[model samples]
Target: MALTREPPAATVDPSNPNIVRWEDIGLTLIHNFITEEEEAAMIEAFHAQDPQKEGKRRISQHFGYHFDYTTFGASETHLTPVPSYITNFLPRLPIQTYLPDQFTVQYYPPGTGIPPHVDTHSMFDEALYSLSFGSAVPMQFRMSGPNDARKMRLPKRSVQRKSDENTEPASSPATAEQTQANAQAQDAEEQSACWEILLPPRSLLLMTGPSRYGYTHAIRPRKTDVIDGKTVPRQGRYSITMRTVRRGDEIGCNCAYPGVCDARIREEMAARRDGAI
Candidate 1:
């Protein structure tokens, strides 16, 4: 395919292009995101700034350690804070924001990794902008076709299936109608968009477009033989997923703090405070 030469300038879209490989995907990279020294510093900060130990934020299923500072969003994110070298090479792309939400650093220790899941946003197309450092992990991509199955666990045999395989692993066999139900089940599970790529250290991974709709991507953590032998333990992996949120309502709170309160509460709080004067 000829490179469309996307203006070497980033462009926004209701439909944004998801790049699987730079040589083919057409999206320009931001740069070698971090130097070895910088990576070391951030990794040190990640481990030192533990959410479990810190009281400001809570630990999440996203894995690894995370830091959700109260003022994270208010900071001036652009202007090449880390220097032009780390600034975006594709300026036309959506200017990544570190909105007012709590910061989360997902650590995939070796074999430990996040399963395939869609982001939980109700409105407006958003993006998952991630900066990776240290080592490389293969992210898996799967497409969601017409049928649906939202919940089904996989056994060891199914875990080895290729990323393109379409059959669902049901606990038992099914008849025609039953098969339809199973297909629906599988489709529901596969409905969300997904695409995965290995993000080596000092690299960035942006998930949007079909990645947000047609599929859910997963980072297959690096695994190794464990002492128990029956299980393979994961190695150390950390990724920072910064994103925007869409609330499917006329009104919503933009605060990064997710579980504490809804937009209504914020409005009510503002009203009460204003009346005090």
Candidate 2:
């Protein structure tokens, strides 16, 4: 009889402090949150489309390919939208309320992954959660500045500008308050530790506290992570990045996937509990 291996129970516990598991900020899985149908559909479309990848080292935007609730229109279900696979479980998890109101999909094909970088924005906290699908790839979590990552695209002088350019962390600000604020703000930029892990398909990675805000994470150079001794080159992959973003132009906004709309928005939840979303 062929033994069947069950999928890793979708987990959302606080990241481990000793090594940063998933229990640092009180995150536990409320429910699996997403269905096989939804996951398969998204993966199928993403692979079929094969969005043009800007390539590795592109820090201005998504390195491989990009799609998200804002651009794709994912405000149908509750628990803060962006689909339940990534964000809905946060409320029950150890992670405190400071959640991001956003969720994005990232596609990484062979030889493609984000360079070492930190995701910062007023609307986004220090954490980044990822749900991978389609294929397996190793995501290199690292601390990169000018010496670390060669290319960067930090666009603002505010919290978002995160580059090791002409501006040093200390010289970036002026007054003492500004310095303290900058130091406090750039706490994650100064980190040096990094972890490299293979994000398998149908798996979830929630980065919080320091992992999100403490240090930079990157897709390290392409290499084989000796699994069962079979060298696995990178393959096309997809992810459902769920998070909480401050409500946007709720009314004017609409679903905008160049691929598929799956539009069923604006209908009240009470009217339809079919769970098609």
Candidate 3:
């Protein structure tokens, strides 16, 4: 857990018009982070890769490093280098101190979603970025608790277009002022239970600090999402998550949230057991 290098800054500028900052949780969303053509190319590249035939609900591929889900650990050995399609876009991301060497590309079909969990702190560095494209989805975030985390499942309901009689109008792209106003309103209404945010197609989501370490994010399984009181249909979504791998003597993570930091928690437990003996 010793310092291998200076930690990268996790701060985001509030003045950036494209950024929607939930400062309280250290989450930021950047709209239109990539061009439409770029998104298409990435999606095509993902398809070109041989698909996994394990009958898994979601399809995923890893580059640079293969992450083991059971252990929540990354292998020290390197895999295939990150393809040019993904590496080319890394420079444009906000992260400046260190470029990510590991990335995972996932394809989510309609009605399929991931369970709530945090990225293992000891495995990667701070500042994780996920670029989403091909469809829009709503991600739910909640503070970690002692109880066993459950997969979120919402009842499937029929979604009607706003133009239909007696239905509310669909949400339109808001001006910067309106977006800020809406975010402020939601801030007041949302409590510690959970907060939901829409991830539009071609948007980039940045998670660092508390958001990256202390909370769990998940997507509810559903064919459609209700946004702004209107129903929006879901489509296949492709997300590219990039992270800097922690290697060598710095493999253990040292962070402020010891309760959540895997390395720190293990050390604390071992020390307590030794003292009792």
Task: Give residue 152's error in model 2 in angstroms.
Answer: 7.7
Residue 119 lDDT in model 3? Answer: 77
Task: Put down candidate 1 lDDT per residue, 133-217, tens digits, no spaces.
Answer: 6566556556533331223122224333444223335555446787677666664544444333445666766655445444545
RMSD of 3: 14.1
Question: Which wins on lDDT, candidate 1 or candidate 2?
Answer: 2
TM-score of 3: 0.74
Model 2 CA lDDT for position 169: 47
**What shift in Å separates residue 274 of candidate 2 from its native position after superposition?**
58
Give candidate 1's error at residue 38 in angstroms: 1.7
Worst 10 residues of 1 by lDDT: 1-10
| Candidate-wise lDDT, in order | 0.44, 0.46, 0.71
For lDDT, the strongest prediction is 3
Whichever of 1 and 3 has more TM-score, that candidate is 3
RMSD of each: 13.7, 15.5, 14.1
Expressed as tens digits, the lDDT of each residue in 1-277 for candidate 2 is 1112222223333454212343542222222334467567766554455545545432212211232324332233433224444444456444566554555566665566564555432234434567667777766554344432222222224424456443444533457675566555444443434445566666556676545543455664464444465887666667655554433543222222111111222232324566644
- What local lDDT does model 3 show for residue 203? 96
TM-score of each: 0.47, 0.47, 0.74
